[model samples]
Target: MQDRSTFHDAATPLPEVAGYRVLRRIADGGMSTVYLARQESLGRDVAIKVMRPEALGDEVSRRRFENEARTIGRLDHPHIVGIHQIGRTADDRPFFVMPHMTRGHLGQRDLAGDEARIREILRALLSALAYAHARGVIHRDVKAENVLFDDADRPLLADFGIALRRGYGSRVTSAGLALGSTAYMAPEQARGEEVDHRADLYAMGVLTWEMLTGRLPFEAQDALSMAVMHAQDPIPRLPPHLRHWQKFIDRSMAKYPLKRHHDAADMLQALERIPYGPQRSFSPRDAAAAGVARMRDLPRGAWIVLGLILAAGLGFGLRHGDDTARGFFRASQPQPAADSMAVGGAAVIDNPDDALLRAAPESEASTLVEDARRQLEQRRLVSPSDDNAYDSLVAVARIAPDHLELPQLSAQLARALATDAVRATKNGDDADARARFERIATLVQATGLADDDLARELRRDTTAALAVRIDAAARRFDREAARKAAALAGVANLDADALGRLRRQAEAIPAVGAVLPGDPARMTVVRSGDGAYALTRRHISRSEYARFAEATGRPATLCRERASVLRVIARRDWTDPGFEQNNADPVVCVSWDDAQAFAQWLGARNGHRYRLPTTVEASGSAAAVGSRAVAEWLLDCEGDCVRRKVRGSSWRRDEDSRARDGGRGYDDVGFRLVREP
Candidate 1:
């Protein structure tokens, strides 16, 4: 895997090819030496993959190397690198030319942390796979190293040197020709059994899992051991956050070919069903194109009707604004002649509430409904699987429930979103799923409670999610988390037994009372020791520091580099501790001088003793075994006042974490002041 580009000068001779000039070597793969060269005839740069000198002697590998050109030439896809031409050297050494991808391979870049981008990447991947599969080409080697990209990070499949095509003669010199990268190969392929497109699908599943979680399902030190592992090992269960894809992965990577999706198209459909992430922006043109594709699948007259609807919608959209025009277009639909009861040759609007829509389709509220419909359609087509923003859709449904198809669509959306919420809950996205369910209830309400059953079910679903979380939190003895979950379940008005059961075993808390300073920081009595003097519950917060700064007119230096990207300048007061620390969190970046100043200010105002804790008081008196409560400042050393002993442990601990010496000085360090009252 050495991508060494050797320059040819006096000592090194420049390599030559048939129709191209080799500028330098780009990479060295297992069977080939890839070169960055300019195709003189085409006047463009290309990557020439030359069969390694050793590989040329092996007739089997040589034939297989030539087969790559034909395999890729037959399977032309945008996401797959295009073959320019095929040629052989004077010695009959095979080589092929392809566009030089500057961005290199997936192995050179990391994508495991980007879930949203990975899902989007998979969309393009499906398009490419479906195209290749239709042409009978199975990309046997689909590891990260074989996937190259352009400057924009759009992936292109490469190295079809070992591809297996159904109708074509494979480069299989023997019945036991070994193929593919070991770590990513399917079980059947690994075992050297007769493989099909399912092997390709298995590799795709393995690649997808690696992209998301950064590890192969089965791995071993040697090829033989790895092959055996793939054949016999049970599919590893995904983490809760990824369990939503369990069935999909299981089906795709099923050991038996018959058990997997029969074709690439079916696997693509399965991928399309997953609610990937946040809503992505899709142009109106894109929506229209998708709409046309969908309409093509419908009856002939449906396209004509669609054209008429778009015409009317555009006219209305322009005249009254996006909402009204959209509303006016749908509301203008001719009422079923027989369904509507006629009153003096005029149709009575169905449902009295929709009379406003029937009265004036040009009304702002009706327009809003129309716009809502357009938004809904775009959302459905653009992100068919994701449960995105529904505020606008719900708002318009309330105005024209009868005239527009809003009521019907709302009900369907309610059911779909509820199902998605349950799926999300199972995937451990409880907060997001709970929010989506709440939105579903709101949408149902906008439809004038048309489906009360759906509303009830949504409420039940939300309650159930909370119950699951509450039980889980309780099991982990996370009382704070359990309390929050139970509070959420209480919103649905759960009966005493169900909700009360979670709160029955109230967590024992120390009887520590708070003493509010004349300033801002609150002091709490140390329950583990005598209740004479209380240690500050937390270190001096930024708010307390701000107050100290404002009153004493002393400068509290604001931290320059803030961790919260979207935070305002006011919040960036110290070094970002890598994660979110709330207003309740102790303030960092304060020097010992700053800590003493605040303590002195509070003491002078309240006429009570306020000071840093003694070393024994911090180590013995404090209940410091929680996740990451801030480390506190201890009194200065016995003789040397310059160095102060810092006590307590944090989420990030060091070797000298408990060595209560005045040695560890830090910019983000915080301190606690104990009151001497």
Candidate 2:
């Protein structure tokens, strides 16, 4: 058999498959090539997997390819990719069509440290596997590459080409080639022994480990070496922060198949029980061990210096009996008998410094405030436990509620957090940005700085950040992100009118894939008798018009320039416009015919219908349209249909609503588009 990598390249022209217009080849595997094509009857995108011509000579490859379509065709589940139809190309090569997953596959996503997203994907895959297992079909290859995501970002298990159904013969594959990925293969599967659904569960375990830690549990130089490692290597431990998931990992990737979860459903249950957040609690012994480990890693010179400091401090406490020394020694002591202290009905591990601060607020307040300032300087805002700025500031507030410097320090910290939020947003880490903003809000309340400058600065920064986030999300057509940003805006106390505008922008993203084509950042969602549609808040700009014109090779028509009366200037078109205007200015001098062409081009490109708004739709938006300095073309025509209706007042003359010849261009005439929902 030929190696899987030795198949046809996408550069080669694809053979026409009946009933589908093949756009391009998306993926190529050992046995087939997947094409992104439009299904003729349904007018929707679908993925068509066609077998390679070379694979036809091999009966085993042929049977496996046919088996994939038949097996998937028999199973019906939302999380599993279903076969729309099975057919053969002109040359008799078998092929199957599936939903076009535009979001790509699991392997392409940056899932590291995104626990919620990882869990969501895992749940979908497990549900799919459970459905398949009940029918006695095991997905032999359950790696990340086989999981695809649809446009809505829902994950679906695909490529059941190498699946093994119960009662199928024990031959895993042809001669020496392994049918599964070595990195995720169970010991039994790696050893060429009989396997069951537990084998699939083991691969799921490997997948879970990879998703959680961003790396595989075991690694080797080659496939055979990796297989050996999977069969014999001890299961690796998760990072200390993710230790809570170790039990799930151990059971899922057990060296022996029998030791793994009994079925996919059982494994999914185990997964659900695992907490999404960190749940590890440290005992005194664990803390001591950690301290010792840190000490061992320290240089000998540092250890001696630490011993001298402790010895000197002890002598000072004994000789002078100073309360500061006493407090220091008290903090150095081990944790109390009770591992955790109850606060506000929640069990939290006691912080020795916090306890000391509460016990002697008068003397410790200044020191705690200084420590907080230092932590803030280091950018250690809310992490590393007893050492972060947040805990230090909170301790100061509790111990000395009336401390003179408390308000200033709290405001500074809030400002720093807001800055971090903006930085995170710029870096495309929206989750971290939101967390920072939430922390700032909580900090203001927790430290009693709500009425101070902290609150004002927070509202200001949040308003600006919300504007950036909402506009960006709308441009990307990410409705969820926009909605979340709107919620954040509400939390920041944005005024009713401004908040409503932002909310409307967020709601319009999915309706049109983005804001209006020309405005770049502003669009209005309008509801009329025809239905809901998105309209550009402004007339199409010069820069936006240039793109359409350049792409379609559209020529500019003569415009009626206003200089010593109106005359059609041969050289004056939208590009020149007979006036000095920037790219941001509304494009003018385009005839009604040109506007229709631009609309058609945009609709075809975005997979959404676009056109000039009807007279009623334009009338409804009369306030916005009349404010602009250009008259816009409307879809309605007058009299013998020789003239198109125009709305809005222009810079030159006031023509609120009138009809003009469709073939001629005017210096003050341009257009806006309505995107159908």
Candidate 3:
């Protein structure tokens, strides 16, 4: 609808309203004219919303308008736009002052993967809804238009003119006196029944859906049909890209009030879990204060139209992250330790020995890499649902003996490499471990892993991370010229704090005590004599020792079993899939908690003794002793600091590494393994 025009000829600009000077019109909304005005005494800008003169002449319309102002005035919520002062013109026309907002609404022009912007918007809206619902105030008209963004880009819900408080339902206009838009109206409101906070949730669901998908769920030709769909229509499914957000969106749009999110607090928690992007700090109360100012000043029609444009723009522009623009849809447990292993993205090597033995010849590996390239080219022809092609390439990397043909591998290889590194560490192998760790740094620098800006930055930062690892290993072990070698390898000191910590840790280990066999750097192999020797050539385990101990104690046969958890660890001579068996990394799938539990179980099974997953730094330090046999593809704590990622691999994919990259990038990919702890 076109905005109402200002009546310039009606009267000369008024000097002040209750000590405020009238300025030019800033916005106009339905039933109100919002003007940008100034409080001379307070030296502040404020928005003054005035009742339409026509409505003022009608006792009923005037009373209804005044009631809205009074209802909003009584509310004090961070999310709900607040009221500062209320006054009347010489003719008794109601005017109210609220804080003035400078930032525009969420319009097509502002939506993008800007972490800060989206966070502000979500926080303000959610906070407002939460506060309003808690105090028995049900904002029947919750929509993008009704939400105002302030200078900080945080949201503030305005236009509570149509709010209905519980126990004051009688004050609400009777049936057929429709309020709120059909596009965002709740089912109860559409049915003309008693409405409550659920109505606001429905509106939020619609708003969030629009933010994600750039469209509404129902596209009816009339208001009645829309209402029908809202009340009884099946929950519409968003695009495949948005399926991951199903639970959040579905609950937000539940048919029953009780079925919807209990409140804004609950909904906001869900929003945080969805992993859109980095978040921006914002304050909703500040924005609401601004909206109040605008409402009190501009002409009603103009303000309404401006608000509509801002809302529409916001809905159109908002997206999850800077990666591929997947369609939007209507959108968390607890505090976990920073050091805990995340099993979402890592690979599991079930038989490290078998994997090493199965490594493919160089020629075969090359051909397999070729085939993977061909398959990637046909991704458009392949079902978007199928992610097998990517996995095949990863499998090739696992079986390759020399880890050659790195360029021909898929992005999945990055994950596989890390998985291999971790596995190698578990078995106490170190050479293969260092190679894989360095390989990851190189991959980030040269590969197409830079699909998104955030990922690219992360990859770049990872390069610096690798250098620090090399230096720490040398200092702790007292290895000669290690720091010089690191510099020669093109690794610079990127993080000062990390380097210092590594130095401190190295000093604590006290250069392997003399005559302690492997404690001495030069005689490390001395400890490998007799029963301690486990060959890299044979993927076999020495179950004899455990068996003998069990027999002496008369334990069960299974109790005597202590086979190598990772039967094999292999890297392809070239990138290829048939090489997966040859490659030998067992794609282990489990949560960080699950992995830790398994490690604990293993320790308990071994007579209450505990084993710990080696930190990435430790595994790298021992690379020389371990690299000859298995590569540690999945060690933790190497990078030192915890950094966040945009996309995570899925748990289902981890069960079978290939599936993890399915549909698109996933953030859950940081999956890791646990040692007997």
Candidate with the greatest TM-score versus the true structure: 2
If the candidates were sorted by their TM-score against the true structure, best first, what order would they fall in? Answer: 2, 1, 3
Q: How many steric overlaps are in each model, in order?
A: 5, 0, 109
How many collisions between residues are there in candidate 2?
0
Clashes of 1: 5
Measured by lDDT, the strongest candidate is 2
Once superposed on the true structure, which residue ranges of model 2 sit more than 4 Å away at CA? 1-11, 172-177, 287-677
The lDDT-based order of candidates, best leading, equals 2, 1, 3
Q: Write the per-residue lDDT of candidate 2 for residues 1-677, one digit (tens) a residue.
A: 11122234657987687778988777778888888889774589987888989999988888888878878876777688877668889888899888877777777667888888887788789888998999989888999888888887888888888888766664634334466888889888888777788989999999999898888998889999999999888999998788878989999999987789988877876775565466656699999999989989999999899999999988887887776657666545566759786889976756645565445444788899989889989988988887998888888889898999888888878788877876775455767877887787777667888543345445545555676678666545566778888876665565676588778888777553234544432566655553445777778888888987875668987777435343532467888766788887888889999998887666544444578988777765643333347888999999987899998778778766878888768888888887654
Pitting candidate 1 against candidate 2, the one with the higher lDDT is: 2
Measured against the true structure, the TM-scores of the candidates, in listed sequence, are 0.42, 0.43, 0.40
lDDT values, one for every candidate: 0.65, 0.77, 0.51
lDDT of 3 by residue, 144-200 (tens): 667776665567788776777767763444335657788888787887777777788
